[model samples]
Target: DAGITQSPRYKITETGRQVTLMCHQTWSHSYMFWYRQDLGHGLRLIYYSAAADITDKGEVPDGYVVSRSKTENFPLTLESATRSQTSVYFCASSIVISYNEQFFGPGTRLTVL
Candidate 1:
């Protein structure tokens, strides 16, 4: 099936290490978003891209970076992983931010030590 997908379904890393979570979609959605699901925060947006090479910071962008060099790919990277950063990360895509429904990929569970 052609849909959005996340890589390394689960990840474990130590503090200060750099880790990248990849998201890819075959549908060529116009917008892509990265969110972290935490205990307190329901789902906070980390970053989003309107189109290839056009990215913007969302609600929470600290310690994280995102880039969309291709419409099909949106990767989120942690410059320096921290224990507090460990959470379930979800990647979503939508054709229109206002009306279209967002399709989400299976989350990547990250554990930082």
Candidate 2:
């Protein structure tokens, strides 16, 4: 039984291109989150969803979009990929908002050249 999974593990794209990272969890977690990790920024929240059709922007939402059509899946899309967007993206899920431990996927490493 898989706890969480991320697609494409690694991607290389050009500037101005569009890229989507897929994330799925086997657990029926109530809260899902997207985060990007960089050298200086560390880990920054990009988006989050509380439930199906209930989504919200996180600390760093620009240049990215997210949607949760199901309780177990949350996808993140980069509208127009940029070199600065190159980072490690992670997806996490939790049973509740800040009260429970979060389960994170392996991660997707994206490089925009």
Candidate 3:
């Protein structure tokens, strides 16, 4: 089965810099989600797309952007990444949110320097 994974397990970036985090899945699930894990955030959704060219903003959509032009790949870009954005980013996919199990990628640790 095709699984999901991420790159640059660790990242050190400064404020006001452009950083792109990559997410790739093999299952070809219809639903893909981007979430940032923080102390109090408890995995707040950044963005989610049901299909290609159809994306909707999630809980905390500010300071980040997502694009899912394809079914197997979704990338997140932080325009002018900020210190507050320093957190572990996780990408997950599932066939359905209500019953299907959500597969989470290894995750990308981004730090603002």
Candidate 4:
């Protein structure tokens, strides 16, 4: 997609299972990000990739992993899903590192049983 696309728009999984959420964009944007919104409230950054193979931890990255093998794709994985990990995961892209208007995907709502 030219803008952004996320898989599993809605999901339900049991606790301790490994789940990977995919995000892809065609803009070749410089920055990509993953955030989780709980109860449709605050969006907390989980991980971000500046470019291919260049990723860093964000505010809530303990249970998440992200990788960018190409400039247009960034995927987020949860090593072991926990109850607290259930939330609406959003993928965003930006042209810069600063406060540029971030473009967000529809989002993936994950539930932990």
Candidate 5:
């Protein structure tokens, strides 16, 4: 089945350390986004890319970086993992930026101690 996948579904790390969350999509959607889901704050966009080599920051991009060297992959890296940044990260893809059909990966649960 062609869909999106996230590696290391669960991860544990310490503050000040770096952690990278990987996201891959087989559908080849033009738009991809990295979002963090936390309690009280349903979901917050961290970053997004329109195509390969083209990316931009979203609502909450601090302490995070994203790159799309290939259309199939969009990896989110937390340069300095913090306890407050601990949340379930989700990668989603869609044909457009509007409210259209989007496919999401299982999610990566990251815990920072």
Candidate 6:
């Protein structure tokens, strides 16, 4: 059984373009998160959802958007892709909000030129 997965393991987009990263998990976890990892900034949360249709902004959410319509899938979209947004993106899921281990997917490396 596949635990978690991400689409387009690598992507390249030009500035001003729109890009969407897809994430899916076999487990029906209640909490899902989107994070971006960069050289200087480390891993920063972009957005997260507690349950289906219940979403909230995270630490850095300026250029990114996320939606969770189903328990197994969460997708992140870049409204207007920018060079500054180039980073490795990861998707994670947890059974609960606290005191639970999160299972992460293979990251998607996005390069905005």
Per-residue accuracy of model 3 over 1-113 as CA lDDT, tens digit each = 55998887999999899999999999889999999999976999999989888899999999888898899999999999999999999999998667888899999999997
Task: List CA RMSD, all candidates.
Answer: 0.7, 0.7, 1.1, 1.3, 0.8, 0.7
lDDT of 4 by residue, 62-107 (tens): 9888888899899999989999998999999999989788999999
Of the candidates numbered 2 and 3, which has the greater TM-score value?
A: 2
Candidate 4 Cα misplacement greater than 4 A, ranges: none
Write the residue-wise lDDT of candidate 5 on 24-92 in tens digits: 999879999999999999989999999999999999999999989999999999999989999999999
**Local distance difference test scores for all models:** 0.96, 0.95, 0.92, 0.92, 0.94, 0.95
Task: Point out the higher-scoring one by lDDT: 2 or 4.
Answer: 2
| Model 6 poorest ten-residue lDDT run | 63-72
| TM-score for each of the candidates | 0.98, 0.97, 0.94, 0.94, 0.97, 0.97
* Candidate 5: Cα lDDT at 57: 93
> Relative to the unseen true structure, what is the C-alpha lDDT of residue 109 in candidate 6, on a scale of 0 to 100?
99
Q: Who wins the lDDT comparison?
A: 1
Task: Tell me which of candidates 3 and 6 scores higher on lDDT.
Answer: 6
Error of 3 at 30 (Å): 0.4
lDDT of 6 by residue, 1-113 (tens): 89999998999999999899999999999999999999988889999999999999999999888889899999999989999999999999999989999999999999999
Cα-based lDDT at residue 90, candidate 1 = 99
Cα displacement (angstroms), candidate 4, residue 98, comes to: 1.2
lDDT of candidate 4 at residue 6, scale 0 to 100: 94
Model 3 alpha-carbon miss at residue 4, Å: 0.2
- State the displacement of the C-alpha of residue 45, model 1, in Å, after optimal TM-score superposition: 0.3
Over the full model, what C-alpha lDDT does candidate 2 score relative to the true structure?
A: 0.95
Q: Per-residue lDDT tens digits of candidate 2, residues 1-95?
A: 99999998999999999999999999999999999999888889999999999999999999999888889889999999999999999999999
**Considering summed lDDT, which 10 consecutive residues are worst modelled in model 1?**
95-104
Q: How accurate locally is residue 42 in candidate 5, as Cα lDDT from 0 to 100?
A: 91
**Cand. 5 TM to true fold:** 0.97
